[model samples]
Target: MLSFESAGRGILCNDAETRPSIWCKGVQPALPLWLASHPDCTPYDPASADEARAILRSALQALYVDHQAGFYYLATHDDTCVDTGPLHRADAQGAIKGMYRLRFTPEVSTVSTASTNGNRKTPPQIRLCGAGKALQRVLHAARLLSQDWGIAAEVWSCPSYTRLAREGRAAARWNMLHPQSRPRRPHIARCLGDSTAPVIAVTGYAQHIAEQIAPFAPGRFVALGATPQRGTAYADFPGAPWITLIALKALVDEGALSAQTLEAALRTYALT
Candidate 1:
């Protein structure tokens, strides 16, 4: 018995409920094949029309394959946009499959590009990861990072933080059980193992959602998201400017950038 329900505030409303169910938030415009591993009901919230279409098709397919008796909730937002150009088919596909490295700058060639070509030095590099609409902001931040600070930023789209976290925990448990065996690596670790550069994962949901990957993140990991202010009932999502600032701050923490440079960026973005 597979049934479906959808609402924009479904996640926000029922997140804390203790039930045998899987909750996927944000705009997931592709298939989550990982659902086969679990028997719980999956409640999905998608913010885009593309998301609704893809999720429906995928959910139906999952229902066809698994004859489990569970309810499938499809939560959708009313806000629709014509500018769906930023949504990449490959990104959504890879993201749902838990591939962290979605887009890389080919010219940069390395995560830590401090190599000296004669007397000229290459820009410092960092990985910026986000999902859904937040990924667009991440892309914008990457461009601004290159243009404003001469930093090489690689963008990664993550559709399911919950899936990544689950895989990470499973890998950890497996590795712990088999101490003598070669440690099993999570998908995120495999994707990010080559780079010692800082990883900044942003989410449209709460910062805690993005923070789930911190335990498995290879190097310096900074999680940014829609964080509730001190006295506000609402949460504010981190935009491109904030993302750029955080990336620069990560560089500063790594000694790649001076404190003065970070301050300059703050003033440049009118954040000060």
Candidate 2:
């Protein structure tokens, strides 16, 4: 069976700079590399809600198409926040097709904002993208804490490193489009609109995934992941929630989320 380690070594033995890595026996078309590497996680568990299950199935289909189409392919490393379900397949497909855009919505509503007045206003909120298991943990923790802290935050399930890399490459190849052919601003850019709030990208592959998405952030941006270091002597699952809490607290210290706001929310909750 082809193994990642053997394939990696073979590339090194050859002209490493010029040779491309090979997909091994372990890699499957239905699963992304991030998910493939982790054996313990059931990446797509059946949801309790039929609607959620249907949406997740679409997400699976989207994931397959995006990667097959040479768009980005990424997935959360493990299951956390089971209630949130999987990424939306329709959105994932649209993102890969370079036709997806996110418009900020008021009051955390999931309903589409297409019918809203063009002049609606909302508070500054950061966009959080989860590119892997570690980053997913951070995203979920930050969102829950942010709510308790009364911070406005939006979490994006970003599984596409390839899509972000392809973002501006088209401009070099296609030239300026006819005004009529030009599509509306990308969803990511619209969500970022004029807000001073930080745009944060989190992933285990910080350099590859996080860095690529940073440019799309609306204002201040942060990429969180491991620093260059020696390989680990062993592997173990880090407590996901603990890691998430630590990351969120760091954001709070950075003023990305307000501690005072959380305290106020807690006070209000206590009184009621």
Evaluate all candidate structures by whole-model CA lDDT and list the values in order: 0.64, 0.41
Candidate 2 regions exceeding 4 Å error are: 1-83, 86-89, 92-124, 172-187, 190-194, 228-272
Top candidate on TM-score is: 1
Weakest 10 consecutive residues of candidate 1 by summed lDDT:
8-17
| Candidate 1 per-residue lDDT over residues 1-272, each given as its tens digit | 12234321111212221111234333231223323234454444343455555555555565556543443544333444223334467645544444445434535434334455544477888998876557777878887887777788887666556667778888999999999999988778877876789999986666766787889877799998775556634455787998999999999999988899888888999997
Worst 10 residues of 2 by lDDT: 10-19
Total clashing pairs in model 2? 5
Task: Give me the overall lDDT of model 1.
Answer: 0.64
| Candidate 1: segments with Cα more than 4 A from true spot | 1-58, 68-93, 104-118, 230-232
Total backbone collisions for each predicted model: 3, 5
Over 193-258, each residue of candidate 2 has an lDDT whose tens digit, in order, gives: 676566555554423435655565656666654433336322222233443344344456667556
